[model samples]
Target: MNSFAKVITTLIGSFTLLIWVGKLDPAPYPLTYPSNFGNRISIPQNNPTTQAGVYLGRNLFYEPLLSANNKISCGSCHEQKRAFTDGKVFSSGVDGTLTSRNSMALVNLLWARRFFWDGRATGLEAQAAFPLSDPHEMGQALTVSAAKLRQSPKYPILFQKAFGDTAITVNRITMAISQFERTLISADSPYDRYLKNTYKPSPIELEGMRLFNTMPQPRKKIRGADCAHCHGGAKTYLELFHNNGLDEISTDKGIAAITGMDSDHGRFKIPTLRNIALTAPYMHDGRFNSLQQVLDHYSEHLKQKHLSPFLKGSSNKIGGTSLQLSAHEKKAVIAFLNMLTDTTFIHNPEFSNPNHP
Candidate 1:
């Protein structure tokens, strides 16, 4: 290659590298998962549990210093009251720009294999960086975040205790925060009680549970609607990402967006039913405003060229063997779902922001 060509390539590479590492100069660039109870959380081995690390991490989670403007923290959107979700169709970013998808709840994130509606992030450690740099989200770059945290009076001691005097780094920060988040646990729901045999279920709830577990096929003896197939077993829920046929053609194209797999289009991770009543506006887009609407969606909205074939009826009905239940039956199912709500989890003081307290 000619010397001029080599020099041009070197300059371009340097510029790209600079852009990647560049912080906000207005200064210049930027800032910055899940817990137990259900199955969505998976605590990494590198950052194991410790009182000091968790304490520091929790402080960071609620601290607005992670963002460039010092106005937003992780808790700003993932409010504990709304089951760790913002209750909006899409999450608002740092500069008032909105993201394309709803902010996912941080419940039981330890069991989730992927993060986001599209499953874009492969790990909790890597996932922390996506929102911080998004101009719409935290509006700060990673390099900027390192410098800011390093200069912070509060974070250095945290870094030392958490990592034995490791430098303030993006990797260390993410790990620490993730360790703290993984401590958010909620396994005391009514469903959990039922599993533990500590509490008795109501009559209607019993029937609904039976129906949910072993309801018959709608038309013929093809098959019954098995809630356990996806949402199954003792946990009362599974953490699989599925299209579930929420839409015939989803523009968001959930898992497909990340993996570039055509079949995974419009698929999203299955949310646990724990506290289902409280976390309203269901689905990836928060389209269902009510639990009744969610039930109605399952009952009436399942359609061909849209829903998964697994849910289709023996007669190839639009919705999987339409439950076509009467209002009373619907009420029964709703009642059963309500049993999953745990007042203790909602009111838990440990999960709340210590700064606010």
Candidate 2:
């Protein structure tokens, strides 16, 4: 090639690179702090998340085209209401086939060391692929999904803007969706304001908080239950997987299914209590109906065999055996749980499905 043509090509390429960097700059938002749940608002070093990428991802997340039948989307199962968890005991899949377990809420997952009750997927990028191609979920293989996206006139344009080119790959799809999902943080609960000391909790709520943070004891009356061992801390959250005696013999041996270890049987990931009021039908199976019921399950139950050794039955509080409150203490604990509900995060426009607009 002539020197003149080479010079022209180099100049054009340099100009294009400069333009790309300018377009990739992120937009601004309010100050965000690392929550107890352990996720950061900023993008990772290698991925270098972009606003355009997150927006494109938000659309794909709600789009039905990812499915072979083009009938179901991720939003179908992880709806914004019910705290991003399907209220159904088990989410219905693409072909109307049923899932094995209830859908878990998408809370502060940045801090989580693992994902899913079975702990199969290790990364959020990896997690998106599971439901997309699962025979029961999105029901489309990555190759099939790529074909659908490539054929879509709009998706090609979206993909080009989010990525460098219009070519769609499974990695880009997963990474973008993970970027959007990572922004699903919740922190403006009543409890947050109380902790910040901007507002004071009610008398009953204060009493409940007192009981919740106290250590477990077996012989002292007029004492609080040791509820804080799993559910307390600055984040007021724990990435715990507890057997919780959900069943006398659990049909679902949670983490054990992921790892073929006998001791891991029946253990499920401990969920963040942030917005606990909105997330109902508690536990791995969604068996307990209310916070009061959950409290009762922990208190009235006799054995702590598989329960974290730090936890003992509430023996000092009511009947020298368990949290045998006069129904009043039980009621107060429920009230404290209510403080964790974050309404702003639930209805925030940013987290809503972008395609809905």
Candidate 3:
């Protein structure tokens, strides 16, 4: 070919490339952290969140098309308004099928090492696939869902934007959804504000905080709620499993179901208390409808045999550790728990459902 012709062909190819780039609507969605969050966020190496990826994830999460019946989406159970929980004892699936356990809150999932009440799934990407095929949840196969997504005009573009290609797969779908979930970091509560010196806790709340952090020392008579032992405090909550004296004999078996170990019986993942006020109907089985009931479980009804060793009674052999909080103390604890509710998180427009289909 002549030099002039080659130069002309190159110019035409450059123009075509520019036009193609302009036609595509892929946008970068970088994850942002609040200054108050400190140095806590540790994104997984494989699924570092991108703006386009998160956008795709949010859409996929809300898309009911993933279900067999095209009637249930991840958002159906994990509603943002209720801090991503369906506010039911067990979340209903397609055709009114109910999940075995309560839908867990999706708040601050980035710090989570294990997913689900039983911790069946290890990574968030793996976790996203569970409900897609669960008989009681979305009730659809990921392969079938991936095929459907591939045929969708909207989803292909989303896939291309997020993953640098138009090819759709179950892994990509799970990764995208997981990326969106990773961005669901909740850290702007009143407790967070107090830490930053932007807000001051109420007197009762301060008292509640004191009790929550205080470890019970019977010798010194420092009777405390000791909630921070499990739930942690203003920062990100701990990700530990415990048999918090919920059952004398295990029916659900919780972690034991996964491990097939008698010692793990009745042990369940301890969820974050960041949005404790909003995520009611507490515990793995959703036995308690209110925070008061949860506190009561700790204070009065704590079981002895299978209780976590962290509890006061587990070591003393006096039975399970009971906070034995007074009515006023319980009220104070509830009040402090209310402060954990991050209004900003629940109402964030970015986290809400998209307007268009």
Candidate 4:
């Protein structure tokens, strides 16, 4: 063959060899969003989504070896059935120590700009690393975790498949788990279908939705529940944190711990209303047991000091901020909140524990 022909042939031969040895670039994982979700998926360029990477993440999420005692995993607190929440007021660690705050559900994490109730971690990967080292949580060092996963016969292979190498690092582990979590989009709720005109809300549910979206304005004669202000928008939910007037005196000091500002005291991430019915014992500390209690707090028991501006005309304790919802209105709002539950995401086989499955 001529010189140019030989060069082309050599390139082809190398490419074929790489493919044969399973070193070729793998295809990306198919991540689909519902029509109502819109264009809101923000994945980091470094940790791009791939089938192998997401699969590795799924395995690591359920791996107990990441814990100090080899008994706790990410799935230990974020169960699949209860919308990724542990269904407890406070999630317990491997040593039976309780977390300070309620375990936030892990749905629709791709849309979240911050993680955790207090908005401590800026991204999902950073959020994943905290529990591993938290004394009350997993209580394992990153170095120890890397060593334990390296010692595992299955993890190295999974790591190689995900990142094209057998080296297991904390960054890689977190990236994989974050990839898996980004796929946990929950948009197929009854309310989502209603928005698409595929499902119609019941009369009470319709009333609740109306109340939720509208803010009460005595000047303009507009009676509203005013919930959509904080939990509103076209996408999954708002990423902002708010002090919902849960108490007159803040106990945990919430986001203030991170910002060290009294203005930020009691401010917590406004969790997505989607699957709100399943994530019971609501609020940062899981102070309310039922949705009714939550509504009652807003309608009749809300404190005035440090209340979010969104609740200016909706909180019961504040003169101008009170929503003043009647018994019927409160029940209707509860019905609408229930419509946000998405059943498909929880039962998805892809999100199930790989070893258990």
Candidate 5:
């Protein structure tokens, strides 16, 4: 061939490569959260959030094909209207098998380093594998699920758009799901609006907010609900685990099951109260059916034996002494808890099932 012909061929090959690269390159996803939520998010360097990846993850989140029976999806247990909690005492899995614990609300997960009630999974990516493989949950093998996605007409193209290839792996699946979950930020509740001076709280709600933040000083006769210790800050909960005085003996063994340390017994992850009003049947075992019941437990029913130090207070009088809140005080506290509900989050179309109208 002549030198001019070879030059033309090289230019044609270069053009084809550019087209291929353009087709595979994913657009960066913009994550928006309240400025009060702080600058840190738990996104991993390997799996940065992208528009194509989040879209793929959202579809996979609602895809029933991930299960053995091809019926239950992650969204089945984590419904959007209920702040991603199914409002069940125990979420039913494939074939009507009950999960060992209640379904946790999937909100503002970008700030969480640990997942689950007992903190079994270290990160969101690792956490996604638990339910997919748990016998009582989705109950499908990761390899089988990957094969199913590979065979699907739509998933291969999605994988290509998200990860620059058509190959589907368990790691990629979890990464995509994690990317979508990180976008589930909820920071526009009444409480948040109150913080921003955009919404005026009622007199009782204002009192409730004040009471919720004040720490109890029994010795000093300072009366307060003392809720801010565990459920405080803009996120409404600390990223640590605690016993919370839930059980005197701790039959389930909570975080101890993972850490194997006696000191960690009865400890569970402190969940965010951002949408606490919507996430009913609170606690690891779903023991309390109402916010009132939860407050009653804290005020009058905290078992002393394995109570967390934060709940113990400064006094030495059996550690788990009641806060002795009056009927009016409890009502005020419940009102404050209700202010955490964000209606905008529950109805956000971006987080809804892509297949639904």
Candidate 6:
């Protein structure tokens, strides 16, 4: 080969090296949340959110190729319009099999340590795998999903941009998905506006807010909804599990299935009320179709033999006798819950399907 041939080969090698290096450094994502949202988010050091990673994750979230039949995606069951919940009692999986529980809303997940009603998954990265491979869900093996992503004309470049290489592994897939999920913050509701002093609640709604935060003191004639014990503060939920008296003997073991402790029986993770008005049917089983039924259950139907201590009344009983909120009071409580619906979140184009206009 001549000197000119050697120079041309060197130029080609340099161009290839530049292309590889160009994708090595993804820009940091501009992550922001409500200032009043309490403690700083605990982002995993290994998978810090990046603009490219979030973009890849967002596309992956809506990509039907992730499922077994190439017809379903994470976005199918967790539609943005219903605050990321599918609005079905139980979401239909890839094979049209029904899920065991209602799909959860994926809002402000950065603050949550546990995933699922049973709290089986310890982190967001681990949580993504369950639905993808669950027999009744997406029903696709992780290896097969990775293979499909790798074969895609677009995913290799996306993986290069997001993970610094074109290696389409399950870990990278989940990490990218978790990055997109962390951006789903819902702090622009009417209730949030009321806290910010930008919006005024009506007389009934204000009364509802007061009642919701107030502790029930039946002996003292103080009527309270006692909601804040499980769902309080700026984030609207305590990151803990509780037996909210859904049944006297719950057929589903809930957190107890994972812990194998009798005390944890029927204990389910406390979900956020940020967009409660839209995420129905409610509860782990999707038993209730409306917020009114949920309120009624707490007010007059709590029946778990071992209810959470927070639900006990002045007499310290494990029954609904503790909270017999009046008809008008129940109405007010529902009004307050409705205030939690953040229209801005559901309509936000940034969180919508990137493939759609």
Clashing pairs in 5: none
Estimate, for each residue in 67-87, the C-alpha lDDT of model 3 and write its tens digit: 989988999999898999988
TM-score for each predicted model, relative to the true structure: 0.82, 0.85, 0.89, 0.91, 0.92, 0.91
- lDDT, ranked from best to worst: 5, 6, 4, 3, 2, 1
* The best candidate in terms of lDDT: 5
Better of 2 and 4 by TM-score: 4
Task: Write down the TM-score for model 1.
Answer: 0.82
Per-model C-alpha RMSD: 14.2, 6.1, 5.1, 5.7, 5.4, 4.7
**Per-residue alpha-carbon lDDT of candidate 6 for residues 197-248, written as tens digits (9 for 90 to 100):** 9999999898899888888765566768868878988778789899988888
Cα TM-score of candidate 4: 0.91
Task: List the lowest-lDDT window of 10 residues for candidate 4.
Answer: 312-321
Query: Over the stretch 208-319, how does candidate 4's per-residue lDDT look in tens digits?
Result: 9988888787666777788888788645388888988888889888889888998888899999887889988899899999999998888776677888766755533235
- Backbone clash numbers for all candidates listed: 21, 2, 1, 6, 0, 0
Give the alpha carbon lDDT tens digit for every residue of 1-357 in model 5: 999999999999999976664466578899987798897779889999999899999999999999999999999999999999999999888868798899999999999998999988889999999999887899998889999998898898888889988899999999999999999989899999999999999988988888798887766666788788788888897798999888889988998998899889999999999899999989989999999999888888877788887677532123437676878888999999999999999999999999995
lDDT by residue (tens digit), candidate 2, 1-357? 899999999999999986775353454223264444344333545454567777777888888999878988888878777668877767777888988777888866555556787767777887889999999888899878888888887777677767767788888888778777776777778888787777789999998888888764545445675567677875676657777655656688788877877778778877878777777777778777788888887777744545544444445653344555547777787888898888888897877887675
- Indicate whether candidate 1 or candidate 2 has the larger lDDT: 2
Query: lDDT at 257 for candidate 5?
Result: 91
- Candidate lDDT (C-alpha), each: 0.70, 0.74, 0.83, 0.85, 0.88, 0.87
The model with the greater lDDT, 2 or 4, is 4
